[model samples]
Target: MIPVGAYARVSEDKALRANAADWREIGEQVAEQFKDMDALAAELGVTITRRYNDNNRPAGDPHIVRNDFEALLVDLENGTVRGILFYHSDRLVRQEYDAARINRLFQLNPTYVGRAVAGGTDLSTQEGRSMLTIQATMGGMEVYSTRRRVARKNKGLAERGHIHGGPRPFGWAEDRRTLHDTEAEELRKAVLAIPGGLTVGEIRKQWIDLGYEPTRNKKKPGTQTLQHSTVETRLINPRICGYRTYLPQAERRDAKRPWMPDFVVRKDGKPVMGNWEAIVSPEEWQACVATIEERKRARVEGRAAHTTSAKYLLSGIARCGKCSFPLMSNQYSKGTASHERYGYRYACLTTLGGCGGVTRVGPPMEHMVEEAFLLEVRRSLGTVAGQVEINETKHDVRLARIDQEIAEVSERRRAKRISMSTALDLIEELEGERDELNRQRRQLVAAKVRRQNISPSLPEEWKGYSVSQRKIRLRESIRAVMVHPAGRGRRFDPSLIEVVWIEGGK
Candidate 1:
């Protein structure tokens, strides 16, 4: 009997359904195809020496590499098998290029045989080669037609604010519309924290400590560890702010694509709001986006410092009075009569390009800053609450008008009443106005939260805050601590340390 190789490939739709539990179904289908191939081979008086199966592998997409198909081609070239057999011609060759490659191989080896159980064509013959090419071309056309249909359906769904299928998002329930209370709250905190200088790593650590797990990985069922990238992605997702987002398949697959406002589907320059409840306000979400973009810019420009939570109160915030360089937290030893006493100090180390003119005991400086911070917080809290409400009201009115103008411009463009250039110019101006309003509104909301968190017992409450939290509050109140050189044997003079408060401070 003549020896031949049998090959089978699973359809792309079935491949998407493949999993550990569902593979048995795919395996049974593959087995039936192989059985048919064997029956055909026996009828042709050929022996099946080997079988090649590209299980759950796509054949139409040229970008997807099929290892088993390549191996079969190698065997044919090396004369390991005299011919090949497949269930169908399309299954064997889905592209004209692939069919041409196989045709050349047949020409090189005249004795080679190729047969398909479904088509009953002798692929080694001239007529059969033509048939294979036609089938492959038809297959490629079908793939493109299906893709276009799916894309249209998805676009319609996105415009209507329907939830297209995927793994359940972190803050939402399985239905994707209902909020998961605990997870949603965490998401809100994370969004609010980002604008306050909290890093993704810090947020991730907090989630882990609180026993919060991300959506379970379907492939790795037992794995529940939350990753930094996952946290950042969730925080930046427009879905949390009640907006639906859509991107082309190419952009979605591009790992290097940066998250931007353009990803959100907009009609007439207004975001297409989703059907679900928003976990964070749009202003707060925009604030998070702005903060993330700024961080990316800093990183690209090589100015971003290490994002690990700071251990010292004012390590990076304090600067040298003489050189204006940021001070580093260090340990300094003072010689005593019998032993050396070591203490934590913020110093202007010459090694770090500082003038080495300033050093201060950490405890004293921290205490002074803390007292001043609490005093400022108490004074500002009373005045900020009433002003924030008035500003928020004013912002809301202007923002509404801006949105109306943008919508009108878009409508005019759609109706062919305005040229594209004219519409774009009007929309750009309106968008800038809208952005500034949102930014101002975000600041008001953040101030309100800060005010609500502080009470008459702020000093007692401040003691409970973590170092990172304290640093955030300090930064909001004070711009920098400029430490001047102290004369030798000066008795810890408060005169040498000058605290430059942020604007609107005493």
Candidate 2:
């Protein structure tokens, strides 16, 4: 018997409507469709040699890359199969372009043919091609119809003051319009407390402490936590203030113009009040918004969040002598009883995590290190600065010469005096020299400027350097400042601090 191939497709959306118990039921449906193709093959006196089934697949677009369809096409082109069988032509292709592709294949391979079991259509005949084309056109129309139906339904639901379909919001019941009493009460209490100096982070911690659980939604499975961002988001939503803002899918896609969920939409020249109870007054909501803004300003200004405007002098350079991990600066509140004792310290990550025990007081250690560094710089400033200036001048002169040579070579190449290959080689050599000189010039200029910026005669010039500027100066001379902790209850010692000097440093 002549070998034939069979193809079957069933979309996930269709199987879901059929009330498929699981993927197994969908697989059974696919197998049943293949049996129909097998029956057709038996009638045609051809054995069903290979079967291709695309379960949970979309056939609306010809441009979509279907794995099984491509494989079947590969087999057909290789002349492994003389005929192809399908449950229906629409299952093989829904788009007109896909139908044209099938027609092209039949033209290329005259012996190859397509037969659909349901419609009894054949690709080998003109009348059968017409039938397949009409079926595909109708299938494409059905996709558009489905989309229009969904769009109309969603728009109607939105006008009725309800979200089309999504997971229920935190304070709302499954019906959406009705508020969940307990959740609403908790939310109201949280929002009310925000302006009273309680932060979003603090509110989250309070909710966790009180053992508050999140509302369960069928659409979103898994336990959810009341995070700081979540609290901040809930506080800012206008839904709690009794207004609905209709944000379409298109509006949400424009990232530059992000849809603010807290904004109230005007309908018929008036604000559309949501058909839900308000959790808090609009005035209270605005207060919460103001509080969040104030917190953000404070963090950026470094008045909060324990960050310093000045760079920590030894941030990346300092390492724990025991674990070899970089030391991090720890900031403490000012004017505490132990402000002078523990205000600032360089604490190792390993030591903090109980891997080792090494920490250094920031102020005293930094003061000692800087005093020693500056003294050394003062001793060699004249000799080092003069050499850097001379090297910078030499690099500039050589770079000018290299540029002139490159221009001469390019002009020669354009004039056809030298072969293209010879001109390219010379130009490449000159460009390399120019790059090297530029790099050297940058290094020498930076060194010269750094020395000029530092005035040994004026002690105040040293203090004028910002935290980042001081770090740059220190890095040039020091590789690492390895801190060995002084024993517990012992006096601070500069002898314990080991400053490893960088190679060729001042």
Top lDDT hit:
1
Cα lDDT of model 2 by residue, 1-506, tens digit: 77778988887645454665555235766878888887888788888888887887889854457778778887887878877899888899898887877777787876676888888789888788888888999999998688677767766555566654656777888887788977888889777655443456666776777765454433343456756656667777767877666655444555544424323454443336767778876556645565455556767886445332235777777888877777888875687744667578787865456335677778888898898788878786656543423344665556566667777898998999999999999988876676455445434544543445455553455675555456656876788898886688777888888999877675
Off by over 4 Å in 1: 12-25, 210-218, 221-225, 255-261, 332-343, 384-461, 489-491
Residue 260 lDDT in candidate 2: 46
lDDT of model 1, residue 180: 89
Per-residue CA lDDT of model 1 for 1-506, tens digit only, reads 88889998886435435545656235656778899999998888999999998877778888788887899899998889889999998788888999998888988887788998887668878999888889999999998888788888888888889888888899888898999868999899889777665767888899889876667555664467877777878888889889898876655667465464546776654578888889988767866766666566667887556575657889768999889999998865556421243368788989988889887778788888888788776676656543424244567767677778888899999999999999999999987777666656655655555544556776777776668768767876788999888886675777788899776544
RMSD of 1: 4.9
Q: TM-score of the candidate numbered 1?
A: 0.81
> In order, what lDDT does every prediction score?
0.78, 0.70
Enumerate residue pairs that collide in model 1. none
Against the hidden reference, what TM-scores do the models get?
0.81, 0.46
Which 10-residue window in model 1 sums to the lowest lDDT?
333-342
